[model samples]
Target: MNPEAWVALALSLKVAAWATAINLLLGTAMGFALARWRFPGRELLDALLTLPMVLPPTVLGYYLLVLLGKRGWLGGWLHEQLGITLIFSWQGAVVAASVVAFPLVLKSARAAFENVDPQLERAARVLGLSEAAVFMRVSLPMAWRGILAGVLLAFARALGEFGATLMVAGSIPGQTQTLSIAVYEAVQAGQDASANTLVLITSLSCIAVLLSARWLAPQRSAA
Candidate 1:
């Protein structure tokens, strides 16, 4: 294997890890809000949250590119205020992966939050526990297994993200190239050995994550 291949693998892992972490935090918060709150436009938010799951990855990537491009509103503001550029960079890959993987985490976390009995929360409140304390102590622990499963699922999704990432990050070798991008480039260039190796690695990673999620799911049910 070329040193470039190893560099691509490490960068891919780094991007995926950061993307999964951001998705886990944001998705969990969104899920909790959806399950517990009754705010105006809640339905709209829910629909938008699930949009990426339904849309083509290329479409999602295109929209993100526009939204994060230098001339775009948010992108302009970011560049002016923070002097940061997101497009065609490793950080951009992380953002794209997080956007695409968010729905999985949100769905899992919402279901987990809903499964916890409201009565338990009420009892905690009666016992003089603050809302935050009740949630941290009584609710979060009960849903920990589901949250773990959600995080794993998000991690898997992020690892496999290709279209959106490619469009936004541009497959720069040793910089923004990820496992999926590497595989695609190798196949295009008729580098079958490298492509095959990448495919095998990706498949194994996916299988391992799925198995772990399944194992954790049963624990959530038991709890």
Candidate 2:
């Protein structure tokens, strides 16, 4: 691969890593809450969270663009007050990837958390462990492997994100261009070699992530 391809690959990894790192904690919390707690509008929240799973990537991207574009209220306030512009930037790509990938990790974590015995938590509480202590020492350790598998899956999903990324990040080569975007542009420009190179790398990366997930959580493996 050339320097540009290498850059795209690097950026893709960076974006995926950032997205996964953030969502790991956030998604785990969301999953735990959804799985263990019942409150008003819980089902509504679940449906909203799962929207990305069923919605078209472009549709999600469009929503994000509208929500984060300069003219949008949140986006306008962010830019005006905080000077953080999301549209057409790498940050925008990360945001897009994170949103698209969130469902995977969230659903996986929810299932993992559900599989844990509630009695274990009660036992920890009875031992005088604070909620935080129990979570860190008991709950987290027991559920970590399953959670890790979900994170890997989310990373892989983020790595391959295209439509939403393009809508928000606008595929600027060596800047916001990720492997998936690079492949799209290469094919569009009839650069078969470039496209093939990116495809090969992406395929290998996805396979590696999936294998790692299986290794970490073999019991959760589908196949």
TM-score of each: 0.93, 0.94
Q: Relative to the true structure, how large is the alpha-carbon lDDT of every model?
A: 0.89, 0.90
> What C-alpha lDDT does candidate 1 achieve relative to the native structure?
0.89
How much does candidate 1 score in TM-score? 0.93
**Which lDDT tens digits does candidate 2 get at residues 138-165?**
8777777668878998999999999999
Tens-digit lDDT string for candidate 1 (1-223): 6787778778877988998899888998888889889999988999899899889999999999999999989888999999999999999999999999899889888888989999999999999999889889988888777778778988988998999999999988988999899999999999999998888888887898899788877876787
- Ten residues in sequence with the least summed lDDT for candidate 1: 1-10
C-alpha lDDT (0 to 100) for residue 141 of candidate 1: 80
192: Cα error in model 1, Å: 1.1
Candidate 1: lDDT of 67? 98
